[model samples]
Target: MTTAARYATFGVREAHGVSPAYERLALAVAQDDEVLALLEALPPAKRQPNLLFSVVRLLGGPVEEPAAFHDYVVANWPAIEPEMRTRWTQTNEPGRCAVLLPVLAALPQPLALLEVGASAGLCLYPDRYAYRYGEHLLGAGEPVLDCVATGVPLPDRRPEVVWRAGLDLNPLDVTDPADVAWLDALIWPEHTHRRARLRAAAAMVAADPPLLVRGDVVDDLPALAAQAPADATLVVFHSSVLYLVPEPRRDAFAELVRGLPGHWVANETPEVLGCDGLPEPPSEAQHNVLALDGKPLAWTRGHGQALSWFG
Candidate 1:
């Protein structure tokens, strides 16, 4: 798809209903030839709506008004371009833990989780947070994640996570003010609740950080996986991450992770992992297919707002 079309698609498919501000800005950017031309100068990946908008927000540029946004970008392209090129759309949303909770709880006790694209490793502490699946509640703590779940056996308890680690090309440190600011910037402008949640989850992680490794997901995964205790169930997992990787690398990672012992949970766009036989997502809105051991189990909303079980 063309850069303009990608922006338009993101406005319709992602930002619509989710963030009206982003939707309007994205649609405006799609139509603005001047802005599109400026974006075209960057690499294709760097032209993403999320990356562009986040960079602008991070730099204290305007995003609420399209005319002001365009003027700011044009004037500040030098500053914005470098940030867009270096920084990624690492939306480390801990709410996604709600979608994985049911699967993790069903698995054997004492799981050793190794997240593939663990931005800040905020998700590594699923057991440390509470969950609300409709009226059914599990665990008890701050950052209570609520999800609209169907056909899912609401987990009776949180998974026993004895060992939690993560592998990322660029692992974010929750304690670092700058890293934490980028995380907060990635969130949509309208999501006040999510911003609060990010702060809460950040505090939880900073208090007792997990073992985070800066390495390639495909090449460095096995070494980290080996570090998990032999007695615990080693469950390799990732959410909304693999899509950033090239198709070939994603396939290689999938093949390698499947060969590892214990469960493999993937929550990504169906096309990203090429998980076949997935039922049509319950809604026309985009969703990530939640799969366990390569079996498509449910369709999950991005940022873990809801889940629809295939069973």
Candidate 2:
């Protein structure tokens, strides 16, 4: 309820201060009464109101120069009055800047991004847009999410981004406008800014689509890896998903990821999540980087934060 775990739930600080939209919402943690109520009414089971898990339909956003997010919330009263309905909203929408940077850094240029838990593909389309990290700008409209940790420097030279694709145990295909809208529904109506960002991101997907496959991570990741395009840095990644797999299943999934050809990235911890099988993190924090062979690469402050690269 009270800003759970620094930057644990939202990617507000992850993208840095450039996202005027997210910044506004993050700062709104104080001013907005609705958000405060939602937080106060935090679900006892989860401790935090994850706006990403709802199965309901979210109404679309204003086309251009939309009103402030405050306006949108008032209009969607019936769907969101009780507010905690969409518990996993932010969980599925990728905006965590800290965890994404290092994953990108460890890859070879022109790499093929194969995301394992790509919920609504919010981050799958990161490269297609321009970002604002304070004053810096990166990637004009691609699916790569460039994160700027407070103490870390972002890579100026980008890898040759050959292809961006993802596989999810339950993938949300944006090509299906309704699916995209449903994903939007997961956003907390109180946070108008987030809705705006989701809308803009969805529009991009409407243009150029990312390849998404539906399958279980434990059962499907190995096949996904085998079928990945050759010679590309095979970076397999996931966030907040490890906790859901039962421990035995989690171990199996980890083994599958560890044995894969390229690299692996994960942002999760069983101690702090609803995910079933996860163990305590490699460390206390559910954030860090690993080599393709399962060696610890760097200890990041959080995902997308800086890394203490072993190399």
Candidate 3:
């Protein structure tokens, strides 16, 4: 695809669903020749325009106007170069815990939770953060998260996570200043609430961090799942992670989950599992379709900000 076309497609397929500010920025980037050239200069693997955009904003670049944002990108190309090469757009969003709540609520307590592609393992602490879904209010503490729910009933109480561990290609350490800063950089400029929540979640994990193992998800998942307590209900879960897996390996991951002893919860794009009854995602923006044991549950916004439950 042409540069403009690729970026335009990104704007529609990814950014449009994220937020209005992001959609506008992506569309503007799609049209600007200079910016496109700058982005195109990067290696194909490093050509994530959204990450570039988020990095610029994280560095205090102009975000109020598209023209100024474009100028900032051009001017800061030198500084941004290193980040583009080194960083993957790994956003460890804790807000996704809201979507996981309803599913967790339905499961038996004293669960052994294992997350694949668990960036920083923030979602592993679903019980830590407060949640509000319609009239239902759950959890209490400094970092309260809210989600709009429809059709599905809210989880009555947080699942008792007897054992918790995460698997990722590169697991982040909450105690590390640099790792924490990079996570902060990954957040969009407009979402100050999310940034604050990230910091709070990071602090919570720092007090007692979850076990995060670095390895390929498909190869390492079995061993990691084996480590869970045998008596507890083993729940293997992932959100928005499988899309990163290559097409061939995605099926392998699914088969691995199917072979496992317990239930599986996935919040990913519609086509990732190809499961029946999964709802069609919106044409304009990406949505994380939630499923439990291959049954469609709900369709949610990327960050778990909104949900259309199919319960």
Largest lDDT belongs to which candidate? 1
Higher lDDT: candidate 2 or 3? 3
Ranking by TM-score: 1, 3, 2
Candidate 3's residue-wise lDDT over 64-122, tens digit each?
A: 57889888888889998888887777789999989888888788777899999898999
Candidate 3 whole-model C-alpha lDDT, 0 to 1: 0.83
For model 1, residues 96-212, the per-residue Cα lDDT tens digits are 999999999999989999998999999999899999987898888899998999999887889999999999999999989999999989999989999999999999999999999
Residue-level lDDT of model 2, residues 82-167, one tens digit each, is 54443333345555533465457546765777787777666664344555454556656533343444433555543455677777
- Candidate 1 runs further than 4 Å off: none
Q: TM-score of every model?
A: 0.98, 0.61, 0.91
Q: Point out the higher-scoring one by lDDT: 1 or 3.
A: 1
lDDT of 1: 0.92
TM accuracy, model 3: 0.91
Count of clashing residue pairs in every prediction: 0, 36, 0
Residue-level error in angstroms, candidate 3, position 171: 1.4
For model 1, which pairs clash?
A: none
lDDT of each: 0.92, 0.53, 0.83
